[model samples]
Target: MEVFVARSHPVDTHVGNRLRQRRALLGMSQTDLGNAVGLTFQQVQKYERGFNRISSSRLFEFSKVLDVPVEHFFDGMGATAVAAKRKPGRPRAPEKPADSDLNTKRETLELVRAYYKIRSKSLREKTRDLIIALARD
Candidate 1:
């Protein structure tokens, strides 16, 4: 007889990635998020790693504490990941999207945090232009 063991859903992974990104962007530690959401840091770590699924109510609470809309967690998830949430068994691996590169990189996140910290809009724009020009070279 075959035993059916459930694996982590792709949507769950995507949500976790979003959660981690948002938390990092805010410079919040796992302990900080845990305290805000009434959970342990280990629980927050599990959620961020997609080792456990997040309940809707719990997700809503996280959204409130993170200062983001509930939909934010679902952002950038592909159709395959969304569909996997509705189906029962293990899902097929998804195709990698080109733009997903930046999203998965620590450097990109750090750059984003630093970019937002720039107080002057003109300076930010100039910096953006410089980066674009550098990227073309």
Candidate 2:
């Protein structure tokens, strides 16, 4: 007996493009990637052309062979588009912190301003003591 399977919305074309792009970025030829992923250059060509469907097990194997996260294949797509492309639960990078949260040379500027404002050594010493105390974690 034999079993049959079918893909509802085939996305191998897009996956193939991504794979080829990443492979080229990694400086790998189709034959080189085939060697790494345990396929012949012809098979790699088929995959790149969307003439073949990649399985989950084979995808994991490819991830191991290519030294990349499985999620690397799918990034920056719509909810439906990505779901159609691959499995559920793709990893997401964190949101960037606000500009106000990142400080650069702010302390140096504050110190220079305070130093220029103070004329007496005793006042500077008091300000330094207060700054050190405030800085204590």
**lDDT of each structure?**
0.83, 0.61
| Cα lDDT tens digits for candidate 1, 64-103 | 9989999999988877776765445545565453236577
User: For candidate 1, what is the lDDT?
Assistant: 0.83
Worst 10 residues of 1 by lDDT: 90-99
Say which candidate scores most in TM-score: 1
Clashes of each: 0, 0
Compared with the true structure, the alpha-carbon lDDT of candidate 2 equals 0.61
Roughly what TM-score does model 2 have, to 2 decimal places?
0.48
lDDT of model 2 at position 23? 65
